[model samples]
Target: MLAYIGKRLMQSVITLLVIITIVFLLLRLLPEEGYLGAAAEKMTPEQQEVYLTNLGLRDPILVQLGNFYSNLAQGDLGKSITYRTDVPVVEIIADKILYSLFFGLGAVVLALLIGVPLGILMAQMKGRWLDRLGTGYIVFVVAVPAMVYYLLIQVYVTDFFRLPMLFDEDRPISWILPLISLALGPIASYAMWMRRYMVDELNKDYIQLARAKGVRERTLMFRHVMRNAFIPMAQYLPATILFTITGSIYIESLYSIPGMGGLLVDAIQRQDNAVVQGLVLIFSSLGIIGLFLGDIVMSLVDPRIKLGRGESVR
Candidate 1:
């Protein structure tokens, strides 16, 4: 198991390195306009060369790349170019990430809590009214775009409930509506997938055997069916939890939340290469780590899932 984990860790590192290389090259290859912020554009050619030299942009490409990696190793993500001169990228993210993470995690956890039980109930009551209602909800949430629902919530739900539409750090309650809105689609997805997996489990030969052996219906559903059905769902838990840090651009924008989600967009529009590159690297690393953790979690959930072997242990 340790060997398998070590192998996966190596692969993840390689993958992250590749992603960094690609992003770095792409950012560098962009038009020089990317680096020419308002202050930079005003400089004479000599002053510009000095400025670029100070930024180490005057160095050879390989040298710059080496410096970037060296600085990154020392926990320096570089200074923001257009956003705020000399402000560390990490500092900017630290201030805004918590709100987005808190809201995002609230949404994800709430979705799982409600979606799983409802899905089980729906599957157990297949072809009944409850099943229809649950299925209808999944379809509705999936069919409608998130932005449409976000707008409707911002208008109708907030107005009717007299809740704050905008996020206010002083009042924690202000986060509720955005959390619900962000969770809508994920809730539906979890419900549909959980229902599908549970239903599939219900039809298995083992389930039939348990029934034939006079096992109680409740025990059969909860113990055997649920356990097996949940293995696949568990794989997503790590990714879902980790991705909360990335935030939702649409949700944050609608609620006027200052979060990391909108930072990338603003950076790109302003051609802040450092901020853009840093954000991309952060997001990509999180995604890669999430995938790695998911695989490990999946292996733990089912002993049959050998990490580096093909055949199951039985």
Candidate 2:
């Protein structure tokens, strides 16, 4: 297990480095004006060249790459070049991450609480009205474009409930719409997958044998069916939770939530290369970490699964 973990960690590091290098090189291909901001308009070619040189933009690509890595090793993510000019990228992200974290956490909690039970109920009541109702909801959520529902919720729901249309930190009630919007997709996803897994478990021979042995339906459902069904789901839980906590870009932007998601969008629109680079690096790192943790979690949840080669148990 330790060896497997070590191997994964090394792979993650290599992947991250490759992603960062690719993004850095690509950003360099953008026009130099992104690095100078509005001030570039006033500067003569000579002055601009001088400015770019001072910023080390004129350095050889190899040298710049070396410098980037050196600074990265020391935790310096550089400064925002256009969006909130001169501010450290880390500082900008730190100021914005809390909002994303708060809403993201709320959304995940809401999704789990509602989605899991809905799935279980649907599974227990298969071929009944309740099952059909849950299935309909899942279908609607999955089929509809997210933006349409998000806008409807913002417009109609807010109007009906007399809630604020946009996010307002001072008005706690305003947080509701955005949180709900963020959770909708996840809720549908969890419900559909949970129901499918439970139903699959119910059809297996083990379940038939247990039923033949006179195990109570409820006991068999929860202890045997759900337990085994959840093993495969465990592999994705960490990744799902981690990604959810990173915030939804469309939801955050629609609600004007001032989160990491919106920040990335704003940086891209404004051509803030530094901020974009920093956010991309952070996001990529999180994705890698999430996958790494997911593997460990799956191994821990099911003893039959082994991380090391040639070590599977029947």
For each candidate, C-alpha RMSD in Å? Answer: 2.1, 1.7
What TM-score goes with each of the models?
Answer: 0.93, 0.96
Q: After superposition, how far is residue 100 of candidate 2 from its true place, in Å?
A: 1.1
User: How close to the true structure is residue 274 of candidate 2, measured as C-alpha lDDT?
Assistant: 78
lDDT of each: 0.84, 0.88
Q: Which residue pairs collide in model 2, if any? A: none
- Show where candidate 2 strays beyond 4 Å: 311-314
Whose TM-score is greatest here?
2
* Regions more than 4 Å wrong, model 1: none
Q: What's model 2's lDDT at 129?
A: 99
